[model samples]
Target: MATGDAKLILPFNSAFSSSYWMRWQTPVCFLITVSPGIAAALMLYRLKRRRGCDHLPAAATWAPCFRGVPPLVLPVYRGLVVISMISVLYCLLRLNGLVEFYFYTQWTFLLVIIYFLIGTIISAHGCWVYYRQRRRQGVEEGNRFLTFNRDDNVDNHTALVTADNNSGGKLEDKRAGTWGYCMQIIYQTCGGAVMLTDVVFWCILVPYMSSAHFSVNLVMGCMHSLNLLFLLVDTLLNSMPFPWFRMAYFILWSCTYVIFQWILHACGFSWWPYPFLELATPWAPLWYFCMALIHVPCYGAYWLIVKAKNTYFPRFFPHSYVSL
Candidate 1:
């Protein structure tokens, strides 16, 4: 079956010359492709009645990554950095920073690691502030932490005094927010990038590429799947908001990659990392167009996972869910 799949993708010409994909791949791919449209349409069904998709206030800022997360959530964020760092070290050691024209997956995987590392630092600092403020305020009671405040305004929420300036203004407006805004952008974006890059690599690229004699190593599999696994686990554990409008960031991330690839090709790199990225193919335009469309569903899938957690977990275990 693997070899047959490879033969089906013989070349750019195969897209026109063959009907094999129509037999099996078509139905599956079609369903994957259309589901996003269906989801978006359904979401917009009430668009007319409502002002628009209501967004979390924290999600609107560049900070707070949707604030008031439980301290336990810190470990989940840290775990991503730990796992991704290991994966990255493994890749870097093996590849030794070799040639550049390999795959966009590697680039995106590295980006995710950096994203998590930065977020981990920011979240850690936030957790520290969260605790220190409580201690200072003398709110030693356990209930102080239980009150979930997702607001971005820190004036009343946190008692942590910002570094004062000679002019009597709080210097730079410091608090748990110092890292929250930027971390929020990267965290939301990395979620989609990690999922899109891995899902496509494992489901679509691997079977086809491996059949074409591309070596499928254990490390490669780990690199792809581990990212999604870590993020999914974090999502299930964390109370952070995952707003759908953040799909804008995901799309921009991919476009920036495409632009980078183009710049590399302009300099000297002759090969396209992913086959679909090669523009000489007759179906290249379609490939690019489909990829642009794919981002919507890829992001929405994660969005739904977060949404389900928010909607159902509270009903099943209200007390436990609050702690999440």
Candidate 2:
């Protein structure tokens, strides 16, 4: 019942666009979005059911294989997470309240926030483990030094090496656990979601809808920009491997949102958040198909960034950098 450029509309009880569901475009739009969702769902199911198919190395660790990376990286990264979360929350507050959460931008932003929160907890545990291992190694080395008997000292050193190997094996097993998989999937999903949200908002919505339905403000700008900014910084810092197969999860994420919109409209909710999503238009099929195809480049671009970092960093800073 909102008026003017409010982007709200009366439910089905109000006057209908007679052509809304009557056109051939409706089913075409449905197929464009939902078919990929179905295929992606099946792909994920098989991935989980099949052994050796999905290898989720722990993305939570500062450096998975190499301990030479400074332990301070964890604490500093946690500080960045806290700052990013606060800024996003402030922007949400400026947009009014929880009602703003209705938009997909907010959904993706919230996912990024959740990822950071989970990351903070995991990284804190890593910091404790790092310092504890350093202390244990120092104490053991000191005890070996006190034993001047060279043979006995050698035996003690061998025992320490064996124990370290056992602990490392356990850590590798932990990396394949369920929580590790969740973190990796969330990271990949956020990669695609943020890209799509920003691109559509700035390039399409801002140009076309700004004069009529869309309002561009500082808070809205930050919501779009900061989501990608924070995620990009995390990608640069974290040791996570971005396997391209996890793009299935990204497709599923967007599909769920599109299906949600369809369900709302079916239930007599009238508002279409973006005009291209409106099925009443004859171009709806074209828009939906284009949206579907755009996922590839959106995700591929982020993948390329990660690939470039891994390829170039080790060469440039051979002493300091470690590629995942």
Kindly report which residue stretches of model 1 are placed more than 4 angstroms away from their true locations once superposed: 1-80, 96-102, 137-142, 148-178, 210-212
Clashing residue pair totals per candidate (backbone < 3 A): 5, 0
Candidate with the greatest TM-score versus the true structure:
2
The digit string of per-residue lDDT tens for model 2 on 175-289 reads: 4356666777888999988998999888887777655445676667777888888888777777677878889999999998888887767766677777778887788899999
Give a tens-digit lDDT track for model 1, residues 39-70. 55555455535753432222222123223445
Q: What is every candidate's alpha-carbon RMSD to the true fold?
A: 9.2, 6.9
lDDT leader? 2
lDDT of 2 at 163: 27
Per-model CA lDDT versus the true structure: 0.56, 0.68
RMSD after Cα superposition, model 2: 6.9
